[model samples]
Target chain A: MTRYLRDIFFALAALTIFVAASPVQAQSNSGPLRIEITEGVIEPLPFAIPEFIAGSSRVEDAASDITRVIAADLAGTGLFREIPRSAHISPITSFDSPVQYSDWQAINAQALITGSVSMEGGQLVVRFRLFDVFSQEPLGSGLQFVGDPDSWRRMAHNVADQVYERITGEGGYFDSRVTFVAEEGPKNARLKRIAIMDYDGANVQFLTDSRSLVLAPRFSPDGQSILYTSYETGFPQIYLMDLGTVRARVLDSQDGFMSFAPRFSPNGRSVVYSLETGGNTDIYLMDIASGRRTRLTDSPSIETAPSFSPDGSQIVFESDRSGSQQLYIMSASGGEARRISRNAGRYGTPVWSPRGDLIAFTNQQGGRFHIGVMRTDGGEERLLTSSFLDEGPTWAPNGRVIMFTRETAGADGAPAIYSVDISGRNLQRVSTPGMASDPSWSPLLQ
Target chain B: MKLFSKLIGVVALLALTACGGGGYFGDSPISGAPGGEAAGSADPNSVAYFNQTIGDRVLFVVDEHTLTSQARATLDDQADWLLRNMEFNILVEGHADEQGTREYNLALGARRAASVQTYLISRGITSGRIRTVSYGKERPIEICSAESCYSQNRRAVSVISAGPGA
Candidate 1:
């Protein structure tokens, strides 16, 4: 299995180079038109994914399930529309067989994904290949992933990621996870728990019971730990929990001081959060290992929601020092700060995108709350979502999408997680059993 | 009618106790209860009376934290009540409307609560007897989106406790 993986990786690298060297074909000339997905309205590229051919009867069900998941992952992005199986001119049956490219092309399936699943030593080995139906060539070399049967969904996501990367020329966030607050009960006395799930909102596992309120569960850079603020101790305090062991410990728990809104630094060696001392709130950074504390801002005005840039050289945060809440960027080590948001509204929760190109934030103006994005210099501000209350924007690993909490108004109001492309398209409500909020997207799985 | 009013008061007390902290509407009387000053502020010396009559909370404009004249007047009454009841300590919970970011609202809530604390201190209240926490936009008295509801939701409520420490 290990040898098979090595050979597949080499073949993929070689195929990628070959594709890069070839001249791109136009849709009029036909073969496969290399989708140049830049900006503007996107008509989803139509694709066909047949059921994986099972190598043995034992893996038959796993084969079909994996294929469905892979198709769903691609279709959910709104970038690719899956051609219905009913429209297929041919069905894929054998693991090793010649493809009928003409048949797929006749059905207008520009891309075809085929795979096989087999059981080896009580583990599942899934190999897949993507073909440009019109180009009459494999878009990327065939590859396989080996994992336990329970992780079949992850393996399927891996395949989808490869296809997405090949077609879009960008990394895929399909295999990531989201940590959010699951809410229940009434608005006045809502019960909230820390819950983590697959990026598509599956396999939900509650990390904490709803005994106490938990807010803002942020994944570490490595996706192995979570930083959140909890009122379990009867006051707001920052807690770090390892996802594997579920053991949590409070950080910088100084007596009489309230700490919340904690975010991990880019390197995961330190955390920046808001600490309230004697009725004054300011941003503080603390080393995870050394417990060294550095006060980032000493202003009498409130300073919080500190987010580190991808390079860790600077931090963007929300402050009211300008007489109203707004975004400000300052050196990570703490010094002179410059205001970033110059709009006529209160901007807060400024999160630097993983790509470090844009900053997503919550903006309140015109008697409405909006989740918006702006360039690093606070220019080109674009509001992606507006509603009764939309806030707390978290970026996908690739920074192409953002997930936030949108709550309806009135006595029955409740929050649910929603995601949208950076261009303000493909708005989707993430599936959750109950009301959910404060979604923090994890980096892609290793 | 007197017996009915007393029964209503008992039920209101029970509801408040069952709520653990407080209801979303604060001390607003429940449905079917008499809708006058007598129904809400029956206990003159109690916290319920303070909340419903003497004003346990102060409202703020959209994002502003500066105290209004009405807020100052309320704080003056709260200071006098705190002085008279020396056995009690207070926790001021600052809250914001649901129109802001979670963390930002928290900071705004803290600012609002601190504004109240500062006013009370200026009115001769001891600093050590008071503690402040910001709920941000998490808890709202009015969950609607209009300005009327937002104005009510952006408030800081003083919760009195038994001890001198918060």
Candidate 2:
């Protein structure tokens, strides 16, 4: 028999009063190592995002809309609350002058984001800088990006990226693109195809013509290729496409079997996929160069959704060999599989983090779907986001954020992509105009 | 989530062409039954009960299954006809827009079908006679990238089976 402790809550209440008057709370220290009362008391930084000053040119108003999108992208994370432009005491019309920090501080803004737009060599060039109001210094030098004026919105996202990184010490997700399946039509006769869009949903481009169903479009580590399963051949076959060149080729494998659920290895040298033969699905690895195939799992039960660890030494996949779908980690060369998820629900879509510390997976328990993560050792499982349906989590390059598709039921049932930090701090919807699914995050393209 | 898996499993089954012997569906007269039938008649030559208007579709709110006024109107006609015939049962296949997750769409689709089932039940149709399944967004009818296709895709289709009454 185990003993139960019922006095813990009461005991903690008495201890709180003693710690309140501790000497550590009396004096304030400014160094990085000082323990301050910032925990739980710290509030989100507030800043004003004035409409970007557009350059006088032949084009329409581009900078204002671009900056607005950037501001929305940054503020959507819930980390930075945007102060209304009405509260700004200083008008930041130019990017050349050093910011007056006192003016911002009076308005309670701890940070300021300023940028300029101009036409250089017939191309749009955007220069942007971010400042820390308290330190009264620029966090870093300003950055300039060149692209078509049509891509001004994307350039704005890049500017937001620079500011986000400087403040959070983490890489930004705004600069990447997500490739997913765009859907239309009835459930039984749904038409789907490959599509790509800017991280903020500005430029939605259909990559493949709608001929067959597509599932799980994963970007290569290098951001150059997409590996996905297409039903176009009348059977699920893994096709690898060079998205930059619009060149497509099927990853060569044996015929008479279906191959689905493809993801590139971390190093981008090999492809891990599920091959179905004789009614059984198993994980298989294919050499991208020689087209050689290696079976990783030999089981009668369904075993799909194979992902590689960052080091490419181990593979994490979902299998029902244990009577329920659970995450399993095995040597990349295929031996000694061990289960990682001990939760009550079946888990699938185990994506290893780029940092090699955790594996993000989809969990189904208590009739709800959740996106959760666990250490590589299968310890410390933490569910990040819970929803009606939140599956297919892909990792940000820094491994601090997880982005997945969240589709809600409605008269015109719609789906949207969403991202949450691993600490479950920032939960924001990544909006796309059309229905979006199977969102695989790309590594930092910068 | 369950419905999403079922939809995906059906899709995978379709991908593999590997479903066990179309059992229970192959021999049924509704298997190859063309659209139409005599009201409450059992004749094999009679068109299957519950005439489905071609290209008729229903709309859903964003990520929800509850029928809109338009969807209710569409289902109302079908429900009235099904009530008159008394022999028809329907399989409501729920679907979702492309913007959502697959499994949630499946659940959303199921919820949509259940919503229709509730509507039909409120309209005096037997709950036992109506079965609900969601294909999620796995199957879409429209292939284009416009609202024209999206509106058509988000629907609860009524597939009438040749049961006792019809």
Candidate 3:
């Protein structure tokens, strides 16, 4: 306990120093000039990203590319708008040069980012700092990251994560990957393969071929393994694949039953999924290590799509026991469940947000499907998007955005992945080469 | 007269190639017959006859698993055919339209297949002679978004297989 308290004291002391070092301005007597950004209409904050200084000739190309990636990452969130490079009045040629706040403020730039990249002993080093132009002070202390030259994109993502966190007070999801089902072929005979890619839809790698049908690819807590259901043996069964080795093995393939919709617990020790027995489906929890199976729900009605709360203390799922599909919450260990959705439509695919505040789901009403969210206790129901078919909502690591599948209407319509902010703003399509669906966002990358 | 002769030559060539039975086109028709049965021979006791003639599939309403009157009529023919063809067992496959969540649709398909199995049992078909599998919306015969396509996709098909005793 003494050691724990000492650690807390040291953390608090560091936080104090961090705030004291930053040059935060006091509110003027005239009015509050600084943006509070509590709620309501949001105009994107404008920022300028000058070309990073290449400390050596070897890293010149990488320096510019990394700078553009960082700018794009911030701009893509719809929270920050990047100032064009042609409009810049000041050029940063040295890593140690002081920022010309007057020039940036004249151009209406609120934030200025300056960085330098160098290659040292076959390793790449990135050093950067953010400044508040209006206050003429650095927003935070300068930071440096060292990594291999091959991992330049990851390094760029790490820098962007730090910058976003410093400004928003919430962790950024830039340094993450999404696992989804890549689909192709005609609609009647669509072939699906499991694919994984960076959060920005780069570095896509197919984990499974289209020989067998697969669904619901989920990442483990550590992002080193994946859990999906495949119909390889003419029956749907859960399989776990090691991302590092690309090897897969079936998990808990009982002779007479099918298991699917599996999700890892918060601790990553157990998996909760739905199992069908004698045509009655129920949720089950299995220990990945010991292979011990425990039934969570024994109801005759269909209960599936179970997602664990971030704390692993509770689970939110969809059930049809009340004559129609609706959202329900119950203890993680299972027993009595309370219906949370009192709306008129049918709700399914309820996934608990990583922030543990809301549950995202797919609500169908009047021949339309909507991606919606509600509080943990089912208050404040808000629909983020509506379409012919939109389902399978997966929360971003910070729970600020949701990615789901949207299929158009027609015979040739195919499923594509899309994302929307939790506030129902900034709806964007995540571009894949072809069709994709059932996206599962990994936790923030290391 | 020239077109008739050309058509006859094509049919004769097709028959010769089918008898040769080595290449892709040498095989029998893909749909009408199974197990290399003759193309024109429609044995009433054969699985193909049951599938093509008696209608091995039954459609359902949207988000419903209960058997409709028309669905029951088809199942009646299926059960009667199964009783006559005692050497063959059956597998009931349940399917759904692309209107619901994947997991829930899977469960719905299961319920649909179970409903068919129950109907077959009530018609005096032994439980041991039947099996069930639910493909949900994964295997849709029709791929459009209209009610016509959806109704066709929401179906349970009775697939026939020769039992172990056969």
Q: What is the interface RMSD of each candidate, in Å?
A: 3.7, 10.5, 6.8
Q: All models: lDDT?
A: 0.81, 0.67, 0.81
lDDT for residue B164 in candidate 3, whole number 0-100: 57
Worst 10 residues of 1 chain A by lDDT: A7-16
Model 1 interface DockQ: 0.34
What are the per-residue Cα lDDT tens digits for candidate 3 across A126-162?
8888787787777666777777666677778877887
TM-score of 1: 0.87
Range of the 10 consecutive residues with the lowest summed lDDT in candidate 2 chain A: A1-10
Relative to the true structure, candidate 2 reaches a TM of 0.69
Per-residue lDDT over B45-105 for candidate 3, one digit per residue giving the tens place of the 0 to 100 score: 7555665676678889988999999889888988998898787677677789999999999
Q: Write the per-residue lDDT of candidate 2 for residues B14-84, one digit (tens) a residue.
A: 42233211121111222212322224235332223233342124678765556778778877776777776
Candidate 1 lDDT by residue in tens digits, A55-170: 99999899989999999998988888999999998888875577899999999999999989998888788888778887787776677788767777778888999888888877
Q: Residue B126's C-alpha lDDT in candidate 1?
A: 86
lDDT of 2 at A284: 90
Span of ten consecutive residues with least summed lDDT in model 3 chain A: A7-16
Instruction: Please give the range of 10 consecutive residues that has the lowest summed lDDT in model 3 chain B.
Output: B20-29
Looking at candidate 2, what is the lDDT of residue A133? 67
lDDT by residue for model 2 over A188-252, one digit each (tens)? Answer: 34467788776666567777876656777999998878998775654457899887665678885
Off by over 4 Å in 1: A1-33, B1-49, B164-166
